[model samples]
Target: MSYDELKSVLVSLGIPEDDISPEASREEVGLDSIAVVELALVLRREKGVDVTEEEIGGTLTVADVAALVGARTPA
Candidate 1:
């Protein structure tokens, strides 16, 4: 998964670009628990990545999400 694609997913989930940075946590970005769950679903349904809810909850930042998805994505 490309960074842009991940970023787009974040935007679609209601996170603003200004709030999401490589080092910024989801808490810092104002993405609540509900939004994080929805984001996991989006990544699964749209990007074909199978990310668990636990993993989503454990994610620290936008960059972390991207890395997680990227790792699962087929080359």
Candidate 2:
């Protein structure tokens, strides 16, 4: 998925655009547990990627999420 699509998840959650970036950590961008769930749900429904809470919990940055989702794509 594109970085814009990933950023949209944060935008949909009302997070400030300036605070989001591919390199920004989830905590640095104010992504609480609820936001994480919302992100996971969005990725699953909109991007067709199955992400676990534990996976999201362990993420250190937005790029990490992108990589996680990208890596899960079936070949």
Candidate 3:
């Protein structure tokens, strides 16, 4: 997944578009523990990406999350 695609997913999860950015922290974008789990599920089930909550939780910024997702995503 690209940055824009991850941003879109975050948006779908009820995070404000204005709060999302490459440099934005996950917490700054309202991605708490529950949101992280939901994001993992959404990525796996909806987007066919096999990312885990733990992996998502390890990321600091939105751009980091996007990079992790992109690495795990199928080519």
Best by TM-score: 3
CA-lDDT, candidates in order: 0.82, 0.80, 0.95
Give one digit per residue, the lDDT tens place, for model 2 in 4-75: 767777788889999998889989888889888887887778778778777988989988877886786444
Please, what is the TM-score per model?
A: 0.88, 0.81, 0.97
**Model 2 worst lDDT run, 10 consecutive residues:** 66-75
Which of candidates 1 and 3 reaches a greater TM-score?
Answer: 3
Question: Candidate 3 lDDT, tens digit per residue, 26-68?
Answer: 9999999999999999999999898999999999999999999
How many clashing residue pairs, candidate 2?
0
lDDT of 1 by residue, 19-47 (tens): 87878887987767888788888888888
Q: Cα deviation in Å at residue 23, candidate 2?
A: 2.1
Note each model's CA RMSD in angstroms: 1.2, 1.9, 0.6
Report the C-alpha displacement of residue 15, candidate 1, in angstroms. 1.0
| Total backbone collisions for each predicted model | 0, 0, 0
